[model samples]
Target: MSGCNKKKFPAAKDVVLLHQLDRGIFTPSISPFPLKLETYMRMAGISYENDFKNPMGPKGKTPWMTFNGNDYCDSQLCLELLASKFQKDFSSDLTAEERAIARSFQIMTEEHLYWVLVLWRWVYTKGKTLWDVQMNLPTGLRLVMPLAVRRIKAQASAQGLGRHSKDDVIEMGRKDLRAISDYLGTKPYFTGDKPTEMDCAMFGCLAQLVWSMQGSPYEEQMKGEFANLKEFCERMKEKFWPDWDQCLSPPRLNVS
Candidate 1:
């Protein structure tokens, strides 16, 4: 069959993504996991429909997937389920050691870098101000946003990243960026010419740092100090996102 002919057939199954709004644009919510899943699906060449039902899915998190008739929560679990059902192997070509390395990086980005993001965005005063402005809460509810902010702070503290001082947080983030840069070197992706789950994780976090958190100190530091990561974000954007330009555009805050 011709390549174009294959496009005529509908996808074997329907995949509905429940996450934040503004798909194909910058990270829409505070979390990057949802964007990671979306990017991974795109990279895997899977057709799926996006449904902005709520920021939190049935599991009280973003990036949950409903495949055919079954619900799968958690991005990693969703990826595993998709791979198993569709017979798609994202890491098939990887050696045992390579898979280990990739998995390590994935965990580092999620556990460490993710907390750095929370510290910068939810803990720091300047970051909180920008976040609030972008959030654009109503005048009546703006007074109560602090309560929500405090909840986030508490969550971050429990996660152990929000307890550090701002300088410490920045230093931690710098170390992570340096590590990712060193590992990537001149490679096109984390694993080599082809992208992997690790690449998805890295891109998801870096994209938010480089693009979504605009005007923040973290974003400035990433762009200035980590040129390679910035370039990698651009590469992934160009490769996986058809509307990269739109995604890069600054979000339209609903200030009313």
Candidate 2:
């Protein structure tokens, strides 16, 4: 019997990311997963094109990537695939224990923190108002915004985080932020001076919470209490986003 050989895939030169628009620093991404993937690419020095339309790729999700000729979905899976293909390990310098710790925090951020963000944006009134303003939907499409909110609420409910009272959910999110802040005390990055996959994961979550969810109770709490986390986000933004000021400028409108 002949053994099946692994197919050698070509190195990806042109990579395209479909994600939400840049609405100033307030909301770098409407969804965190795509932001995570984008941050990862930047950290790895991989050049990619940004395509905002039709965010749901082949897998019906944002953050999906088109590499070479194939489509890859899910942030974690896409990271693994890109790392393997490019021979770049985001955690290559970490010790075994550090890697394990990073993985744990990454999972916590994605699984737990992400849901809290969803609830904050779609379920709560204050957060929903902020989201609407940042989204800046057209007057015609504004009528459907409530329907969109309802759909998101249903999704949150199915995901189980929405089952809890709003207070409980906020508390859970606060605890998560506290844990991350404590772990990140006085460090330039999550794993020390250098940014790792953990930092990428964390930056994705914290950046949105701190900058995008401004005026919400959660953001207020973070700013008032978690100094380290706020500093961490700022540091990352300065280091990775050299065009930060450009990103904040409003898009030029076309006049007829």
How well is each residue in 1-256 modelled by candidate 2, as lDDT tens digits? 1112133224446664434444443545656777677778888877777655545555556666666756676877887777777777867888999888878888898998898887877668624454332544334444576787788788888989988999999889889888888888888898888997778778888887777765666766677679788888898888888776665535336411
Which stretches in model 1 have alpha-carbon errors above 4 Å?
Answer: 1-12, 23-30, 126-141, 246-254
Q: Which numbered prediction scores highest in TM-score against the true structure?
A: 2
Among all windows of 10 consecutive residues in model 1, the one with the lowest summed lDDT is 1-10
Q: What would the TM-score be for candidate 2 when compared with the true structure?
A: 0.85
Q: What are the lDDT figures for the candidates, one per model?
A: 0.69, 0.71
**With candidate 2 superimposed using the best TM-score fit, by how many Å does residue 246's alpha carbon deviate from the native?**
1.7
Clashing pairs in 2: 26-212
For model 2, the superposed segments whose C-alpha errors exceed 4 Å read 1-14, 17-25, 130-141, 249-256
